[model samples]
Target chain A: MKTRLTGRVWKYGDDVNTDVIFPGKYTYSIADPREMALHALEDLDPGFVAAVRPGDIIVAGKNWGCGSSREQAVVCLKEAGVGAIVARSFARIYFRNAINQALPIVTCDAVDGVENGDEITIDFAAGTVKTPRRVFTFPPLPAEVLEIIEDGGLIPHVRKQLGR
Target chain B: MGKTFAEKVLAQKAGLQQITAGQIVTVKPDRLLTHDNTSAIAATFRKIGVARVADPSMNVIVLDHVTPAANETYAISHQATRAFVAEQEIAAFYDIGEGICHQVLPEKGHAWPGAVIVGSDSHTPTAGAFGAFAAGIGRTEAAAVMATGEIWLRVPESIRVQLHGTLPARVSAKDVSLYLIGLLRADGADYCSVEFAGEAINAMSVGERMTLTNMSAEMGAKNAVVEPDEKTLAWLAGRVTQPFAPVYADADATYASVIEMDTTTLAPQVACPHTVDNVAPITEVAGKRVDQVLIGTCTNGRLEDLRAAAEILRGKHIARSVRLLILPASREILQAALAEGIITDLIAAGATLLNPGCGPCLGAHQGCLAPGEAVLSTSNRNFKGRMGSKDAAIYLGSPATAAATALTGVITDPREV
Candidate 1:
């Protein structure tokens, strides 16, 4: 996993559920990650995909990814080249899915003052996120969780163990 | 400290003598439930390079969401699910018209006490009604479960909710749940397990208790459970033939928090448009015009819920401007309603009876809301675009309230009607 990251921020409010993140209507019809990326945040922010650049960061309020356990939600963001998600909190299943997919998600209170398009820097090991005006800190990821991300997600990690 | 219900269940499943909140352990679920999501899960399962399912008998797939092939996409998805079931030789598959996965599982004796169940859908936690430890997982994790029969989980801290006093005549368990959601806020129980207790819970029937557990997802609960007792066993006597391991928390179980609610004065509640936690008392929002009324879902689609709606619609006429739709949760409940004349009464009152499935709830098909419309429904969610149109609005209410809204063509209080 990348230890240092910088990106322009895209902000959203609380309770950004899975349905809006990646609507259920396309879950079965669309299988490719990049195709699903086109619809990412379409429901909540219609211009999201158009505005999003690769390696951009999403700064959101609490309870991000609150509804439905669709891995597609995480896949969409990863495919769009989102560097990391910084939110005050996240729904549990989404949090686990992000780690398993090697998407960097940080929890921090600095999400409050972060503006859209603000340049931000994140240090995963140091548990610190630096915005234009302030710095926010979160607890470092558990070693086990970091190991999985470092090995390029759980699937690759397991594959390496089996030497496949 | 003594263990909560969640702690005890995880410890037992992990084969550990003791555990605490936040402890991570691997568990082999007794059952893995799936609905429309099974189509996507099948794709992921194949990607894992598993030639055969780890345990075909343990996987239960139900065709509920967008059932009967609402469109070409859904039809193809259903075909994939049927093929997967046939290939895996899964015995517990439910076809279209059978019912919603959550309701059918319990009706068919699959969910039981002391078992750990995971599903690919969010409301899988509904199985906690039978005192089981159940939670929702994503497709990849579900595929891992199918491939290895094992998955990892972190034990969640428990919030003990004590429901006291009697509900008013016009109010029911749906009102109780909506009120609780308002009090707990949307993410109040995030990543935590909730256990319902107290005299009010003791007095509720098993069907009624399910509402409490079913809506726990609205509060972001990992799972919700009601401890099994006589009512639970009585409800299971004929339905569940296999013996089940019944586990309960110790008498002195410690909880992260305890909330004691008095329902005696609780009014019928409704979660307003755009969010489940944006709840308001019925009196405040009454007379707001509605375009539709839906009286079923996993949350409030049981027999008792139908009865509640039927009582209000009996011999009464629905507003001509309103499109009233009633869907029973399962075939068994639908049949029971028909036998009791609830179905006839609802139709006589100008309601349209849709098939027993979840198409309309999640905006897949059936009774979809047009843009700028408002609907009062018994379903769990009211998120934007939840019922097909982002510009439309959805209000979550009890069946009684839904019936009343159908009659008035507005969000009216059942008590006032």
Candidate 2:
């Protein structure tokens, strides 16, 4: 896992739900992770999949991913190569899903300073987000949660625990 | 200081005498729930090299989403789930037509007071209405729980909401929930354990309490509960025969925040398209055109909810321009409605009765909308494109509001009707 990530920001407002992140209609139809990436944010931002680059960060307002417990919502974005997400807050299930998928999530107010296409750096080691204008610090993740992420999410972590 | 309900429960589950908010503890949940997604979770479980589930009896699998196999893909998924259930000897499997996972879980006695339950669906918190510490988990973690029979949870700070006063006629628990969601906003109670109390909550039926807890997910609650009373015990008398202790917050429990509301004059509430918190009083959006009206899903699809709609539509046909759809949350609810003659009344009133499952609420099939059309539903969500075309709209209201709207072919105030 990368301790620091630099990416262009894709910003959004509050209540960016899973329905728009990965449309529910295609849930059962799409089984391939690569195929799932094609539809990320298809409803909320039609151009997201085409324009997003690997390691791009998503900056959003409060309550990001506030609907559904579909892991595909996180899987699609992770497969799309999103490096991290910075939001004021996130729905509980989505937060857990992201960690399980090894997608970096930061809870902070850095969204206020970032804009679309602006370069930002998330330094997990320092628990800070560096925007072009300013730097915002967030509380560091727990050691156990950080270990799960470092092990490339919960699946691999659990596999290692089981000595697989 | 006294401990809150969440603290008390987590502590007990962890085999500790005390625990505080924000501390992480690993405990074995009493039950784990999965719906149609059980197929995907089963695949992940295999990847973990676990040939057998740690505890098959602890798992509850239900086939509800996109039931009857909307297409071959869904059919294959359900088939795989059945195979997994058979192989694992999972005794708590509920096939299609059993109803939604949330509704089926408790009815089958999987949920009870003080139980720690985790599910792969967001509405898993609906079981909290039974006084369980239930929360939604992701598919991957669900697989891990299956392999390890343990889960790590962060004890959440508690929010106490006290309700008082009698609800006016034409007002219901759905209205009270909508009013709270509107007041709290979408993220007001983020990651908090919400506790409902006072005389108003005590007066509500178990189904009504379930509606409140189910809608709590909309406001980002980790879990929500109403303390178990004689009413809860009465509802679970035969279903939950096991001896279990219930947990409650101490009188002086510390809370993150406390809110109080009087429901005597609450009006029917409506959440507009695009966001659950984007709410308005029914009067504000009344007379708005609606092409369809739906009354079902885990949110408001209980027997009482159907009866509420039928009462309004009894001996009255819906408007010609509108299509009214009714789905009972479970086969049990369907049978109860039929026995009560509620289904006949609704069908005679120009409503289409779908099977007892999650029909069209997720937009996978059944009644998707056309662009520029608007539907008023009793479901929990109204996100853009939630039902069909991105350009279409979804409005959320109580079952009473849905019945009145179907009768008028537009959004209508239930009280006014």
Give me the candidate number with maximum DockQ.
2
Docking class of 1: medium
TM of each candidate vs. truth: 0.98, 0.99
Task: For all candidates, state DockQ relative to the true structure.
Answer: 0.59, 0.86
Q: Clashing pairs in model 1?
A: none
lDDT of 1 by residue, A1-164 (tens): 78899999999988899888987667767878989999898789998888788899999999999987888899999898798999999998898889878999898876777999999999987889999989899998777778878988766765564454
Give one digit per residue, the lDDT tens place, for model 2 in A20-81. Answer: 99988988778899999999999999999999999999999999999988889999998998
Q: State the TM-score of the second chain for every model.
A: 0.99, 0.99
Per-residue lDDT tens digits of candidate 1, residues B117-187? 99988898889989999998887778778887888888998999999998889898888998988988888
TM-score of 1: 0.98
